[model samples]
Target: MFQRLFITHPASVGETYFEHMRASLGTAGKLARASAACLVHAIVPGLCKTTGSTAIMALHSEIYPRRFDQPTL
Candidate 1:
């Protein structure tokens, strides 16, 4: 069995959000990390720093890709 995950977001937010994620999560974090990453990351950017925290979720799929650079191994 295999799984794949799709991560996307609007490009309207400033790059700081992405940079924060790149710093906090690091590249490899994406693997063990959950789908919640998308929403969690987006929360700060979308909320304009008004809020401090958010809840996220993960979708389990048999064909979801674990990493962006490589397909499920």
Candidate 2:
């Protein structure tokens, strides 16, 4: 049950638990920064004109190649 809860999903994506944790945290940090930039852009339209969209596109590019069922060697 512990393994299923903490390990399965990460393993399915070809990462160990700690690796997955690090990756998830990094992604969250990026999203948070992007969100802040977006909020700033909303208030002052001229600044950070493409920050949000660029961040989203970069994130999509980073994630698009990952397969959920990648075989682990």
Candidate 3:
């Protein structure tokens, strides 16, 4: 069975993510992103395998909403 963790930050979510990844990958561990939140694809064994494990090592889809207001038409 596989489990995922969801993390929401007011700011610097990317930085935090990279930090976690760096630590995890540095130790040669495994982690998965929560499906409900951002689509985080970790470096899992037999999954998306990578030569090195870093927080920002793998490319992930950032689903953050924009703060800018829409222009009136």
Residues 14-60 of candidate 1: C-alpha lDDT, one tens digit per residue: 33545645633653453335335444557655532322222212222
- Cα TM-score of candidate 1: 0.17
| Stronger candidate by TM-score (1 vs 2) | 2
- Write candidate 3's Cα lDDT for 1-73 as tens digits: 1112333331233446557566546534323432211232343445534332433344222222422343322
lDDT of 2 by residue, 1-73 (tens): 8877888888788899999999999999999999999999999999999999999999999988884544443
Report, for every candidate in turn, its global Cα lDDT versus the true structure: 0.36, 0.90, 0.37
Candidate 2 — which residues are off by over 4 angstroms?
69-73
Count of clashing residue pairs in every prediction: 8, 0, 2
Ranked by lDDT from best down, the candidates are 2, 3, 1
Best by TM-score: 2
Model 1 worst lDDT window (10 residues): 1-10
| Model 3, position 38: C-alpha lDDT score | 26
Query: What value of lDDT does candidate 3 attain over all alpha carbons?
Result: 0.37
- Candidate 2 TM-score over all chains jointly: 0.87
Can you give the lDDT of residue 23 in candidate 2?
96
